[model samples]
Target: MSSDEVTDVIDPRPARRLDVPFQGFVVDMVSDEVDLGEAGGIVRREYVDHPGAVVVVALNEDGDVLLLRQYRHPVGAFLWEAPAGLLDLDGEDPHVAAARELAEEADMNAASWDVLLDLLPTPGGSNEAVRVYLARDLTPVPDDERHTREAEEADMVVVPVPLEEAAALALAGRLHNAATIAGVLAAAIGRASAWETLRPVDSPWEYRKN
Candidate 1:
């Protein structure tokens, strides 16, 4: 079999030049022209230029995972999802960002954190990558420390489901959010292995670096 027939963990892409076709408040549509070496020739592709994000799978001592139900306008549905937020602030650590999202979105904090998974939900269309975190030893934020809610978050609802049940929901397609599905399933699998698959919170994210 040729080398191209075998899938590898890392596939080095060709060189490319990028230009933005449309810029939104939070994201931009970018077009790139790739140099596919002398044999393949050049090709153009367009995709969303995302800022990346962190997702938190906050697990309680009772083995329940915290979730948020908020209206996602793009999907036109109120979906149950893990707490997540973008890495909008320049130079902000992803771990810190994940912690902040847990507090702001779920009014909770965790004493232990581990990297559960990293994923590109729409690799064919967008450069958006998300790191899912497993947070345990949970505690609620103080009333005064809670972030003021606005927009869709103003009506956001928090729910706690057993970790196994959440995994079932993901398999049944009841949980529509990408991060929540991936996080729940990954957490379930990791727990079965006594979390040996977990990575340190500070572990480098190669997708973000690229």
Candidate 2:
């Protein structure tokens, strides 16, 4: 079979299940889950349905990446990340949401954008797909009068980090967000054509001088 036509042969089995609904989210409970009959059973199992989001790795003419440090209530701490947000409740385009989020969260706009990668934040539990985009030729947008409750609660600080330095910080575990790390790595490795290369790969996160 062609590579594209190749498929896995998964055995089927009976399993117990439960669904717990919430006001804004739902929990799926599964017991006596399917066993592939492997020695380790399954390295991962269970899938949670989630609304996907987009992350923009926007770079300016000066070669600085736009990053945000926002206060996360769940973590009860400030975390650095690229501008990102979930699709609209009515189901909006992921790219459109990325552009809108860049504008809404950063007060910035990009002249061009290209998708770098689509990744699952947590495949084992959540089906949250995060689409990372490389944005170049940025333009600043006028501050709008619109904002969301989440935005209002977020004390967002926009900082421009040199691409090289950003990668280094990520390797040092200073940049903890998975999507941001993936986006930066994608840009550094030249997978993202919209970003200019500033270094080479010495490690998964370390960039070498080019």
lDDT, each prediction: 0.90, 0.71
Weakest lDDT window of 10 consecutive positions for candidate 2: 201-210
Candidate 2 Cα lDDT to native: 0.71
Best by TM-score: 1
Q: Write the per-residue lDDT of candidate 1 for residues 1-210, one digit (tens) a residue.
A: 998898426665575657888999888898888777788788888988888899999999999999999999987999999999998887789999999999999999999999998988898898888999999999999998899999999989999999999999988989889888999999999999999999999997877732
lDDT of 2 by residue, 45-163 (tens): 45555567779999899988999988877777788899998764554656678888998888888888877666767756664667788888998886564454366336678899988
Over 4 Å off in model 1, which ranges? 1-18
lDDT of 1 at 101: 96
